[model samples]
Target: MTVYATFDSPLGELLLVGEESATAVGGTALVSLSLPGQKGAAEVRDGWRLAPEEFEEITAQLRAYFAGELTCFSIEFARGAGTDFQRRVWRAVEEIPYGRTATYGQIAERVGSAGAGVRAVGTAIGRNPLLVVRPCHRVIGADGALRGYAGGLPSKERLLGLEGALVP
Candidate 1:
């Protein structure tokens, strides 16, 4: 069964979705994490359980991250969360260290999509389900300009600022 919880964060209310998983922290593997009004945000569908207690570990980790005390996320992801190509793109995104930024073309190269595939890499990054946890905001434009973010550009700027990766 699907389960969800809400977290009031520096950005806004965040929707946290997940499901049971033996290997996940708090026994629930994260499905998605979206900011308020995020594009393609996950909805609290009927029949989904609201179990705040199940997210204790996740919430703590999030708290630490927002407080600038945590650099990496240790949460587990639900199995079969995305297409294979999307997963590959996400894995490449995960390698973008905190406080650093990468260009879409760079990610495309990492995913074996060099040259014309930059757009496809951006598309997959736009669809990243885990938001801050997956660190999609670290992907920027080739000219050092902040580009599209599922959580919107303002939110993306704030996130990068928090990480000290944003230039004046």
Candidate 2:
């Protein structure tokens, strides 16, 4: 079974989900992520419990990321299972950097499956459970516009600004 911990973050409350080995998931500001047609709203409280290693490792990286001193993160995680196409899209998302951005079309090209299209890639991005750790905020619209972010645009803007990439 999957175990979880909840914690407060700059973005709001967060859920840190894990398996036996390591911290596998980190989702922040979960209030708006409530699934549509679900039974009830999702709620998080302060100082929730987590595995010792997961609490230690992921929280440290998250702190560093917020402080702007860390760019890339190395965390032990299980990607679990996904379709080959979803894996390809996630791999491309991993390639996006701290202060840089990529468009959906560009990600489609990078993955190299004909007719896979931006919409398919977007779907994969939406399914990414890792959130800030994976830096999906780095993906943008074709004209350099801020686009849909699973974590929301304000959070995206905050992340980009923290990375020194947000334009005036």
Model 1, C-alpha of 51: deviation from truth (Å)? 0.5
Root-mean-square deviation of each candidate, in angstroms?
A: 0.9, 5.6
> Residue 39 of candidate 1: its Cα lDDT?
92
Candidate lDDT (C-alpha), each: 0.93, 0.67
Model 2 CA RMSD to the hidden true structure, in angstroms: 5.6
Tell me each candidate's TM-score: 0.98, 0.78
lDDT of 2 by residue, 9-122 (tens): 677766665555423334322112222121232343444444435456567777788877789987655555457888788889889888888888899889985355888888
Clashing pairs in 1: none
Candidate 1 per-residue lDDT over residues 64-164, each given as its tens digit: 99999999999998878778999999999999999999999999999999999999999999999999999999999999998999999999999899889
Query: Model 1 scores what on Cα lDDT?
Result: 0.93
The regions of model 2 sitting more than 4 angstroms off are: 22-53, 114-116
